[model samples]
Target: MPVVHHRCRRTEQKAEELTNARSKNRQMGPNTLLAHGPYDPHSLHGFVNPPVIHASTVLFESTDAMRHRKSLPYTYGLRGTPTTKALEDALSELEGADETILVPSGLAAITVPLLAFLGAGDHCLVVDSVYTPTRQFCNGTLRRMGVEIAYFDPHIGAGIADLMKPNTKVVFLEAPGSNTFEMMDVAAVCAAARAGGAVTMLDNTWATPLYFRPIAHGVDLSIHALTKYPGGHSDLMMGSVSATAATAAQLRETQMQIGLNAAPDDVYLVLRGLKTMGVRLERHQASALELARWLERREDVAEVRHPALPSFFDHALYARQFSGCSGLFSFLLPGGFKQAATFLDALELIGLGYSWGGHESLAVAVDLSDRTVAKGPKDGTFIRLQVGLEDVADLKADLEAGFAALAATAGTAG
Candidate 1:
């Protein structure tokens, strides 16, 4: 029986090596041909998709080999397989980071970086308009862990230096702050954090690595919620953190210690989604920008809160920092809750969903007056919109119906 099993193990390793070599040939990292990007041939899976691999126990060669604990490809399924590492390599190359690690979701992406860098008694300066979960985690988990989290205005920029204490360890940033779309000067924030000997991290989910490279502007780490755009089809949930060699080592170590590895299937889905992201993002950008302008011209709108728009308060900062605009934007409705609700309910094509970056449009109302400490967009009523790959004319017509509903509910002219 032992002899038979030994032969079986050898056969499996040979098969795996062939698979790994083929996969490596398909994807390129930082050194592929510039003209022809990495492209996969037609998938052989029955559904034209990569089959999900569920693995856990990875057998080793011998007791001697296992005892040394030396690196021998994938020792355990929990760490990763070729399918998973291929995705990680792809993300690392895209972001120009020395290394990348995947987490379960976008919030996981944020929390893990914070976890690796922060300890009890450390101080962290978080932007006032950061993703709400980040705030909750800081106030709830980080606070309980004895870490001090202080919220600061997104526009503080270089002035954030004032808030840094001697123990300040991290400066967390989110550009074009959630829902309200306020822009942040990443370079300015990094300058402030560096002077105080603090690490800087940002949720680069909006303008993905293709549009913005946070590390080039002095940020220590760049994070992306792959679920939104990178997983453009919305079929998978994943997050990534990419950093320079020095910082990547810390995050990688923490990722292993916390056992935060993602499933190989999720990684495969994201990798597939990433292949055509540029084209999809372009459509999303054009459609959303058109809608932002249309919203700005409406008398019912207080403002079209899109960083790509010239009328946006932080337009100049955005133009300087980013190469492209994303599908996400927000606008202030003429009337607060009553009118906003009416408009949302009257929509035909748009859905009332929590996430964006898919092939569909979504709307959500957010209020931040109570959460911000500094000049955050304290407004009457705010509504965020994610313009999908729909026709501009049809989307505009849908808005017309929504405005009519708002007018009827508020007893105002449309």
Candidate 2:
């Protein structure tokens, strides 16, 4: 007879103990939950962080156990690992979701839920202000899969009910519509979708769960591009989908069947970032609001699209729904593409980048000409900025330089 190791017995005992304690720990506040809910110091020999378990094959001690792997905690790495579970649990707690699924990229988070709910002969209503990549996916892959897609104005609110088809299975939304920062009436749209028997999903990446709890506001499924706020460092790529108890089964099943998994290292990175996300986001929110206000007074700026600003058209709606804002907002410059290029080229401190939610600031020019249901800004060129942790005064000086470049370009054009 083979003797079992004492370490194995200790591990089993600790696992069982922690399993029983999870429900109690979940009742704690968000900050406590993010820091310690997912990890047990006793389980990992008093270590504060969970170990990165890079695994594919999980071995069983007995043939019977191997044959009945479905009863086990983890059967395979593609399904999940200890590292992945920690991140999922933490995210679920923050989002008020019954369960969460991790994916390779933020786009995967959006696409997976659509794939799970929609099939051939199904229709999906997507907001026109959705992320450009999401719009492309709906137009290309979902179209090829024989799913009908329609674009609706983000501000449609309760009017969304009139557009729902009998075959519509999903109503997708992104509040503070991508680039344009137009706020959607989430409760109104969600109520309308629920009446029509369509599942409601929102890309809550901008506000994250810290500032806006989507599930609490009637959203059925909440998605996050973890690459942005959750990751915080601009080094990792991951996405998460959180669902209410009633809808979690289908989402999990679809994810498993598709073999979607976030990398263990990236999962660990995100877990690390979550601890400091609260404070980092507070800084981001402050700097972004200050910059948005300053831009409103600029002669070169045509409009600022941050919802938190009192001057924003949808400020009332934003105030009603969101507890706080993040670092991202857009403004229109007084010139066309040429001036936009000049501004971008002249920036000294901010990087020209596509993604946001990093420690460093970034700037990008947006073109909304492709929008069919919503009109692009008629004033001039659209520019989006991600206000990072940099000093506000320094960032303002950088913008001054950018504006100077825009003026210089206009001078040359004349």
Candidate 3:
């Protein structure tokens, strides 16, 4: 009896500790939360990281248990496991969402909620400067499904209300938009959507939750390409859609109906990556801003489109919306595709690639012909840069080499 009393007392003490820890967690800053927000090491045999549970079928204790499968936190591997839940919980907290659903890829995150909310005869407004894949999906699949799509200027702001019809179901936004880096008036647009009884979804990948929280600003759904900043490494591919309490159930149901699931190992990688996102973003913000500013001063560069830069057209709006900037930005050279290619080919450190947010810097020559509203510089070609964690000085030197090669080639042509 004495031993039983002692064990019970110990249990009570541990329960108290856990409660206190959770209370403290609620008040901790972002960096601290990243390190120790949702995971409980004590609950998992003191393991620092949650176990990667690879599962498809879960065994039940009896017929009664199988009958009441819905009562269990997990029923099947594809539905979810403790591994996926850990990452989901972490992302939910980060994104300020009631719940977050993981998908196989970033584009899946964009499509799931879109497909869930919009149907035949529905009208959807997508920002003109959205990610290329999103535009393609809207034009192809969504349109083919009998949905009417309108591409609005990123700078439309409250003017979006003019375009809203009674059938308008979704307003999609991507601030500091893909390639061109055009900043949107997120709050104004969201407010306009709300007034028109439309749901607002923003692709928040460029400004991760570390820099911005869209839900707090009236966004119904916040989409993230976890393959980018959340994975931290270029090794994994995944996406997540975080929804407000009002929209969570619908978003979740859509994800389930579509049979969407991220690989357990990739989910684990994102979980590990979340712990260091704050620190990694800090470096990305600092280095990218430095590079943007440096490029602005160079005689060869025509324009630099980094929202964080004071000279940028939407700097004030960006300052109001985001806490900080990410490593992706673009600059322009005084020539078209050929000159851009010459410069990129000459670079030794920055690789020419499609994806960004990895540890290594990448550069791409952007094609702006697809845009209807946000046009790229006509006098020059835009070169998008994904400034990585490398020393800013080295990146500058590498860029200088590209400029030298371009100048030499141009002189030979003359």
Candidate 4:
């Protein structure tokens, strides 16, 4: 395998320029930054969008250039292209980080940071409410690598200090955790990790940089699954890891070592998605909150676990930390998995699927039995919904149909 060095003067200069520009426009809101910060239309002959450059081989102009490939802006496609750089720049700005690296998927975004920081004999404190795949990776691969992994309660907050050891290298967190929607005190957890000499990382996919800036909250690395909200169309897959200056080089080196790179086309699509993410997320937030409120009034709903709702246990924390919420949240049905299946089967507008953050509404049955520390809403069947840009009235009507199915199921079962 060819080793491509990423510490090129040209690349650094471009990134520095972007960073300087961002500093000058500190008062600009997210929407304005998303529209114009990372891209320069004038540089590309006044084209609005960055050109997608598809290339694996970057030829040197002379023998001297070939010898100094490490100093050049780009030596190979795997290192990065103009398309990749554009997205990275935009995401870095959004995340409030010094740099951002792209990966093949959201899971990779999580794994890369772990691999970069953890080694044999090291310990990792992972919140139990994390994305299931992330937990699996830690238990399976990290354990096999001789790294000790511990699942701590999502609500542990400052108490995370007790769980840390001298060998602890990373404290992993997912705010308003997966499926269960339990929020963590991010600043508190980061403080604990920092005091214990452990790096703090967060999966910021749900809130994004628009609602929650993880780096600003003292996180060392901010990870995002661009597959969801950033893709916005369900047509692409990519993930990003944005890091502070102290950790950026290590992340980039580990990424290069692992040969983790997203496709150029996928990078372009995500860049396109980022442009409209702010507006799309606003719709998602409004529709989801409206739907959550409607579900709260229903007699069949056992519980609504949306952080944006005042009823949620962590609503106060969410209010203080997050600027807004996304479209994804979970609700509990009255019965077991049977009732949940029936409810899903009855939905007309909401599609039953695995991934969200697209233009369409989706619902999935969630079972948290595998969770040891943070078993969520175990009394009833959990249903996670991703509200799309559909009309709120229509979405409410769709859920009304789902509830009708749940009621019919109960009647039949009785």
Candidate 5:
């Protein structure tokens, strides 16, 4: 007679339910799918949230079970717990990916795929306006390792093909690139990368999956900083790399080999945040667009770099690709760093900080000195703003004060 463990049977049953749910989830709207993603109340004794399983060890039923531990749901905590699986499964669904892997921070999401797909002799193409940390890693680590790195214009589009060498293994993209918010031709870049036999990866954190799904548009791996909108709060730090069927194995293998894992508690928080992501993002988009419009009209503002705004250079491209906009965007203030400092010093409600996609509004003075190309207006101070879920009227008043302070500064200089 053969023995069947209750826990193992339960795990198998749960996996089946999740697989079935994923198919049905594709039919639901983003908001509806988010609420029901991969979490079955019936399976967990009528609990709405998945249980956070803090674990490092797995108990086996017998000699056969121990010998074939690979067949089990989870072998160790570092591999994943129920909590981690819940989040990963949800992200995979949102991203329209075969699998989604977790890491400690948003930057890890970028580095993991780079490491997975590139080697010493391989060449990589990165957007000129990529996140500063990504550029730093390529210049420092990837360069030191003998990987040939090249930066390209964010708007290079299908022209990226010209830069592809025989060894170009990866082409990294960040649309509405970093602080300057320059939009890219995502589909064109991905297609060119595919034709060149190079893997394509995009930092989709700014748009989240709700606004954009990278895999559907030929991207092999869609990267996100779950610490932002997915966490919806400023408390936790985590990142995710969602991969298509072609890239999933490599992404997962690299993550496992590197022993990378997000904290169970942080994963749980992000799962909860996902349920409300749609609603929070609505407020964020509406508020940010309204603010960007107002900034564009002000005399103190030189340029507003929000893709959603019609005044933007790539507004048509942004309109064609993105269904919605996020709260993070930048504006150029007239004058230099000193003038930017004065404007920030006047802000009372918007915090002087780094990172966006939180419940609270934040602003930071951007330094584009490291950029080799696509450097923004050299004469003005670039200020990136993360519009929070604050009252739009109140946010306007705070900025009004900032402009007033600049006026006072000019008066004193005279």
Candidate 6:
């Protein structure tokens, strides 16, 4: 057989196997995760949700199979179980990845893809406003490994073409940067990375695959902190990395070597979370939009960094690439940390917490002087908001109380 034919045949088989895993009844048996989740084939199980499989070990039948660890297929629990497989399969479908690997947290999601694609002496281009820990990983850990990390303005767009180096291995992007929420030109960056022979990875947690599919945008790999949206209840901590067929095999192998596999329960929880994510996101969006509109009209507010908002700096890019928006965003308060603290303390409905993506709204004071390099305002009180599934009117009332407290305490800066 010709080489082209041989390659095509192998690709077809892999695609077929992956497809079988998705349909819930195409012969791989009903995927327990998707039977009521994404892979509902019969549509007759009538269960509104997928069953949660909590298992550390999957027993195999034959001795030969046990010895080779190949009898029932997935050998050990860490390698993943039907539960993990179901979640992986479900996410793989969502992200359009040839394969997916689960990790313990959202940060793990960032580090796994980084470690998989980069090596000593290789160069990395990272967005400045990335999740702080991710920026730290590139500077601290990747630097320790002799890898060079370069920071380019997030809004550089196609001009990023100028930053490419011969040793550039990967380009890391986070749309609407974690704290400041400035949308980047995802397609432009991926195109430049492709021409420069570097893989592109995006931390797509802000929008999730439901709102934005990175694979369709030419990204080589997509990372998610399933802890946020996919694990919508915020009860489970999980991360995932998705890649096309060529890179997925390598990612899976690297994932095993690092032993960063997430627990089966986490996998199950994430799977369950995925079911209502679409609906939950709509709720989040509604509340967030109302809240952002309210903040924009606030006496102490300088700017709102929501992509869906017309006032956001990168609203144009976001409007171009994203199908819809999510609830996570930030805004600038007039005073610095003092006002942020005052407003947070005054809030009755929102919690002041380090982490977000929960049923309850959250607020935090963030400083961006060191991180903000673009045309963003120079000095402002940074407050990030994770708009939760709450009544917009109630959330607004809570914020109104917060503003009242801020006015009383800070005397209301224009």
- Write down the lDDT that model 2 would get: 0.91
Report the lDDT tens digits of candidate 3 across residue range 1-414: 999788767766775798687777676788988997677766664678999999999999899999999899988998899999999998898888999999999999999999999999999999999999999999999999999999988888899999999999999999779998888888899999999999999999999998999998999999999999989889999999999999999988888999999999999999988889889999998999889989999999999999999999889999998999899999989988999999999999999888888889999999888888887667889999998999999999999999999999989999
Q: Which prediction has the highest TM-score against the true structure? A: 3
In order, the Cα lDDT scores of the candidates are: 0.82, 0.91, 0.91, 0.91, 0.92, 0.80
In model 2, pairs of residues that clash are none
Could you give the C-alpha RMSD of every candidate to the true structure, in order shown? 5.5, 2.9, 1.8, 5.6, 3.1, 7.5
The lDDT leader among the candidates is 5
How much is 370 displaced in model 5, in angstroms?
0.9
Q: At residue 58, what lDDT does model 1 achieve? A: 81
lDDT of 1 by residue, 77-111 (tens): 77777667767767776777788888899999999
Give the total clashing residue pairs for model 3.
0
For 69-121, candidate 4 gives per-residue lDDT tens digits of: 98997989999999899999899988889999999999999999999999999
Could you tell me how far off, in angstroms, the CA of residue 194 lies in candidate 4 after the best superposition?
A: 1.1
Local lDDT at 203 for model 3: 94
Residue 176, model 4, lDDT? 78
Model 1 lDDT vs. the true structure?
0.82
Ranked by TM-score, the better of candidates 4 and 6 is 4
Candidate 4's error at 170, in angstroms?
Answer: 0.7
Question: Against the true structure, what is each candidate's TM-score?
Answer: 0.87, 0.93, 0.96, 0.94, 0.95, 0.86
Rank ordering of all candidates by TM-score, starting from the highest: 3, 5, 4, 2, 1, 6
